[model samples]
Target: MFPYFCLLIVTSFCAITEPFYKKQKSIKCILLSCFIVLVLFSGLRYDVGMDYLSYKTWFLSGRGFSEQGFILLTRIFRSLGPTIGFNFFVFIIAAVTLYGAYRFIYKYSSAPLLSLFIFFCFGQYFISTLNLIRQELVIYVFLGCLLPLIIERHFIKYTLCIATCSYFFHYTALILIGIYFLDRHFSAIIKLSGIALITISSPIIIYLIENSDYAVYLKLDIFVAKVTVLQYYLLALSVIIALLYFKCFQGKPMTKKDILFENINYINILFGIMIIMFSNTPIIQVISRLSYYTMPIYIILIPNFISRLSLRSNRLIFRYAFILLYTLIFLVAITTNGKLQHYVPYHSIIF
Candidate 1:
């Protein structure tokens, strides 16, 4: 727990203060190296999360097609030290995802550091690291890899292929298929209006799901349980983002990319709200996992918005405020429900 807290604090601090040096390759290299070291160290800890144990057992037993790809990949590392090797592999996947996300933002927006900070601050990545949900992690990495192509050319075929591979890793990735179409077509006003409607009607959606016959097929309690806290954050964050968008609107006209990104954010907010509200329902609950797919876009969009700010003081304040908010959230998440564990420090140097 201490190690985890330290990592979050250091990461968040660096994210806030490091933006000025983002163009420096040395800074990127140093930060990247430290991140890798943390990943290696994290492997030394006991398998704290049930998700890790289940995946490890499945890999060891030569399980079915489910997780076969991940199993096959990890099997090679199993020869070294199962837990450490598996952690290394997961770390590489996450690193690649982060790099891909960085490249995506750099390609699309002028402010890459802001984009990276947004991604880091999002609680999902921090919690997922501790939980080690390999499938979801892999899907996120793949989505990051697919971002450049999706944003530049808007090619449906390639997008579908990437989305398919993501779904293969985790069925929840399928929800992103809807997002792809939404990005391509939806206008900002329409998207935001739709999200507002969803937010307003969330309780009704939850009530219907709780009472509906479809509840028999879907076990929504787990989904509901997971989403309650997440929803609160999502709602707050969405409102903040919407306010930013409106505040920034008069200064610069929205670009095509900006519109696309805003629409994506709106869809994510809507999806997140639905998941939170209807977590007790069957199909709607399953839809909640789609939040991960939309998570990166916020990072991509928010930073770009921040970067456009003209005042240095505003940027600094915004950066610190965002980092502090996320850092607090990250702490609360790990410490909640006795989820934190005091396992061996997962450093690279072997003891």
Candidate 2:
């Protein structure tokens, strides 16, 4: 814990002190130092996460028709065995996620360091990566490709990248591809309709899980759990933040880039809420796959909303409220989830 916080402290200091846009060399050096610490921390771990053993087995077995990208990785590691392969995989994920996330912050965010802090606080940077290994890789890889895909309009490169990602994680790839193509503003009526559907569908899904005689046959038995209230809370908070940002911008001039980002953020928010509403449905894994894909939006929007505002009052409120929210999330994570028990007494393969 002490060691880890050192990394965060150094990172936060670098983040807080980073100058505006002039010294590329200094920025690169700090980021590089952070990345090195991150890679060492994640890559050298031994049996650290809940699914560590399972992933080791998966790496060794290397058996799967789907997610050929991971399968291919497993195959490469098969020659060296699970330990080496697992570490290599971890190193790669840490490297790519850090680079991609930092790049994303540099490009789109008004507050790069604050966005990085949010990424850490929001669990995408450290906690989620430790557990959801494959998903993290896919999500970050897709994030790295996002600028080329949409912002820069590099269609061919984006398509190729998406194709490669789909080969690795089909469900996420499909969702991402769909999002890429449909990055347009929906009318308020359409957005509200989707939320209404989520509200109305909850009970129906619960009933199906409880009463259906063929629940096992339909795989509803696998998804017999209830919608996670924590996810709902998160969704609600995100909506409030987005709404606040939008409210601030009313009657103000917005750049085309800002409008585009806002539209896409709305879509991502809706996508997350829809998944949360369907959390107990038979396709819950698919829903889970899709949720991580929406994270880049969270990364961009939260800091952007807080730091980009001309209204200092809004900035103070949003920033403080965000910190408070993160505290609540931490408390809830430790108290509410059993699986996260694996994370306690944090250990690594190397000290």
Name the top lDDT candidate: 2
- Number of colliding residue pairs in each model: 3, 0
- Model 1 residue 24 lDDT? 63
Residue runs of model 2 more than 4 Å from their true location after superposition: 7-32, 80-82, 169-171, 197-213, 216-222, 251-256, 275-286, 311-321, 331-341
Tens-digit lDDT track for model 1 on 255-348? 6566566666676677766766565455464565556666666655666666778998897787777777776776566566434432223333
Across 1-351, the per-residue lDDT of candidate 2 in tens digits comes to: 555456556655655564354676666666656666776777777676787777777777776346867688667766675666677776776677666666766677665655665666555445677777766766766665465566556667777777777776454565666555544455568867877877788668757766777566345465544556656665675687668656876777766556556665666566566666656566555565566766556666777766766787787677666656655665466445524546555567665
* TM agreement with the true structure for every prediction: 0.76, 0.80
Kindly give the stretch of ten consecutive residues in candidate 1 with the minimal lDDT sum: 340-349
Cα TM-score of candidate 1: 0.76
Model 2 misses residue 65 by how many Å? 6.7
lDDT of 2: 0.64
- Cα-based lDDT for every prediction: 0.59, 0.64
